[model samples]
Target: MFDVIIIGAGVSGVSCALILGSAKERPYALNKKIGIITHQKASSLQTAVFNNAYGIPAGKLGSELLEESLAHLSSTYPQVEQIEKEKVISIEDDKTFYKIITNKNVFESKIVVVAIGAGNPMTIEGLEDFVVPHQKVPAIKNRIQLKNNDHLVKDGLYVAGVLAGHRSQLSIAAGSGAAVATDILSLWNDGNHTMVHDAINK
Candidate 1:
């Protein structure tokens, strides 16, 4: 079991995981199968480190921030692992731990962070026959589960990053990941075992 489990390898997930690492917290990432998971890539959302006062820089953000975050995490904790190329089927929570099931593996952790680019898939009635129904995790309030399904757990799941922003930029996603981690760490150390929110929809 992991102390924390972060989903996706995007800036949001990666950056946040790095912070936990820096704080001496060991975390795991359930990304795709790394090598087999085609096109699993990362881009820094640093807004071009140096840009004109007029606007955001259009340059490609590299590994600077991510590298720095990694350095901190590596220095603080020695056992952080990034699991790649795994498609998550669902999440189950029971206050003490979250069980994450992927196509190839299953992982257990105390905190579940959702930094996935967007919310999960949603299924509708009319398009049920025409297209495959996309399922969203259940029990999401602070987190947006793209699906209308009712089977997702309501506790121990944190929905943040691109999923929270309906139409925000990528930079927001990066910060969201870190922010979610901050909240989780805060609550974890405060002796509060709740999921950070009183209600899933409120």
Candidate 2:
């Protein structure tokens, strides 16, 4: 079981893993490889998007930041592993941690961060019936009430970005990731897992 399994390899998930896995005194000091389960391929951030949004000279864009981040992530934490092109179907608890069941493999982690914003499954009527369940058959308004449903046995689960149901921007997602990581780390420290507890606990 991994120390932490972060879903969705978007900016939020990556940022969290980047920060938490790089800690020094942590036993899992090497990143947990933080399971990356996504249905969609992590789109290369268009340099145009950044440039157009932030006036970044329009030329210094395209996968550079992501490339650098990925490189740094690899070089900085030599032990952390990254599994791309994996889509998680469901997250169930395995006593102490969560088990992520994907189409290709299964991963377990003490903590789970759900950063799948609009990426989560949605039932559409016309053509995308197979995407989600019960497309034509309707009950009321929203089909399933997923407020407090936990069939899994995990103890710690965090939600961020759109998955957290917050209409968040890039910076907000980054902060949210930090906050969730801090919370999980706090719990980990309390569980006598690491030295990064004080920063999170306080």
Candidate 3:
């Protein structure tokens, strides 16, 4: 069983998993097994341009970011499993954790982050049979509305990137990933975690 299962290989999903994978001192990094399930490659990363992706100058290829990020993840978290070319059918709550059933395999995890791009929504038959119909869908604003300061769409279910409404932009999507990761860390730490700030103390 994994500690976390991210259902996308896009920037948001990768960013979230990267943070946890690199946090060596944190429980998630040290003890958790993280999984990323995706069909083919991240479509956004393949075709996206960095126009609005803050800090990144225009004209840079999105594929570059994808390659660099994947390289870093592999090096930093060698154990991170990437399940490619598989489409997720549904996510079921198993009381203690979540069961992510895909076309080719099944995964169990304590937490789930749905970061799939908004442009392509998965068509799962009878998804209602497993998870509650809580996640929002295709329409721009229909994306899941996360609870303030937390990424919990519902209990163990979390969301990032376009799934949470920030679509098409890489920077915002990555930022959303970081936000969810921070919240997940807080939850895992029994809500005892504190946010960091670089601003000078008054």
Candidate 4:
């Protein structure tokens, strides 16, 4: 079983994976297994341009940013498995672990983060209860989000990114992902707050 399985490969999901799989003093430092499941399609893929995202060069294509992020995650954290081309269908709570069912395969993990964007309505079986009208981005009437407390849906379950009711902004989504990872790390550290940072070797 994986230590953490993140659903969705958008900015939020990838950012979470990056932190969980980083080579610093944290999850990766502890050799935790991280997995990401996605169908390779994120709302950012359709974005024409990204000029408002922080730290990103102006006039960059949203797709370019996502591609670069994925590439960095893959190359930097080779141990973090990217379960590509798979669409998560449902998530089953199995007491001590979660059974994530996808169109291609089934995965089990100790923790799960749902960062699927709010571009479409959530259809997962056990997660529909948390679905609520998105407070932001009113232009998209069909968009919906999941109710969460600082990205925590319950023990071992979390919601991030747009699905967590955050604005549909790249920086916000990425930050949310990192926040969730930090929370998970804290749990692993016996409730002590944990932070991951890297500095140049001098």
Candidate 5:
């Protein structure tokens, strides 16, 4: 079984996977196998024209930034498995690892991060009202809310990114993703993991 599974290929999901798989003295140091599933490119960012994220010059297209980030991620993390072109059909807890059924394969992971963006509404039992508030527009709704500390969701499930109500900005989404990854790492360390401001410092 994989150690962590991040479901989304957006900035947030990418950042989370990078942190979990590339950190020098954390998740990667412990040899965790991370799997990232995406049906297409990282996110709508590939086509976004935004130019407001930190250090990403005012005129730099979101697509360019995403490309650079992805290239870096690939060169730096060899243990991160990218399951591209596969959409996750369903996720269920089997009393241990999560059973994630995708269009192409089924994966089991000790930890699951649902970083699915808020671009589409996801219907779930009891979350009907929360999924799609403005049915007319049908595009903007908070995906899911996590308990405090973003933990203990069925003993392993975690949520991050726009779906978790974080700002849609690439930088903020990336930060949220890293935060959730840290939380997951902490849990794996038996609550002994301390947050590092940045990987360079640690």
Candidate 6:
């Protein structure tokens, strides 16, 4: 079983994966089996331009940002598995681990983060009870977000990115993802706050 599984490929999802999979510092790293399942598309792809994102160059395509993020995660943390072009059908809590059913395969994990964005509402069995209207974007009807407390939907499950009720901004979504990962790492570190800081070799 994987230690954690993230269900999205947007900026938020990729950011979470980057933090959780980082091997820069051993004491702060999770060093667990992690997997990210994606449909190979993110709502950010629809964005015309991403100029306000902190640290990102102005006038860059959203797709380019996503590509670079994915490339960075892959090259930096090759141990994190990426399952692409697959749709997650449902998630079942098995007491000990979560049984994730996808159109292509079945996987089990100790924790799951839902960062599927707020564009189209995708229904997953057993998660409907937490569904609520997307209040951040009132003009977008039918958009939804999961009820969460500090990104935690319930024990072992979390909601991040715009789906976690954050504004649909690149920096906000990415930061939310990293925050979720830090929370998970804290749990692994016995409730102590943990952070990953890489020191450059001089």
RMSD of each: 10.6, 7.8, 4.8, 1.9, 4.1, 1.9
Model 5: which residue pairs collide?
9-42
List, in order, the clash count of every candidate structure: 12, 4, 0, 0, 1, 0
Residue 106, candidate 3: alpha-carbon lDDT:
83
lDDT of 5 by residue, 29-121 (tens): 477778888655536776787667776677777668666766777788867888878887788777788888887888999888877776544
Q: Which of 1 and 3 is ahead in TM-score?
A: 3
Candidate 5 at residue 154, lDDT? 48
lDDT of 3 by residue, 92-116 (tens): 8888998888988888999899877
User: C-alpha displacement of 8 in model 5, angstroms?
Assistant: 0.9
lDDT of 2 by residue, 75-185 (tens): 875455676678767777666877788778878887777765443343212112213222222434222211212211124666655444333355655666666666665
Residue 103 of candidate 5: its Cα lDDT? 74
| lDDT for each candidate structure | 0.49, 0.54, 0.70, 0.84, 0.70, 0.84
lDDT of 1 by residue, 1-202 (tens): 6767776665567656655554442222222111111113433243435232123355434445445544555465445675656766666655688677777887788767665554324211111221222223233432233331211123455655555443345556656666766666555556443222234786
Q: What's the TM-score of every candidate structure?
A: 0.56, 0.65, 0.77, 0.92, 0.80, 0.92
Candidate 3 residues lying further than 4 Å off, grouped into runs, are 27-29, 120-150, 194-202
Residue 11, candidate 4: Cα error in Å is: 0.6
Residues 1-202 of candidate 6 have per-residue lDDT tens digits of: 9989999888889999999987435564546889998675545565658778899889988777667777888899889999888888899999889999988899999999988887565657778888888878775466788999999999999999988988778889989999999998998888998888777883
* Candidate 6 local Cα displacement, residue 41, angstroms: 3.3
* Winner on TM-score (2 vs 3): 3
What TM-score would you give candidate 3 relative to the actual structure? Answer: 0.77
Candidate 4 lowest-lDDT run of ten: 22-31
Whole-model lDDT for model 3 versus the true structure? 0.70
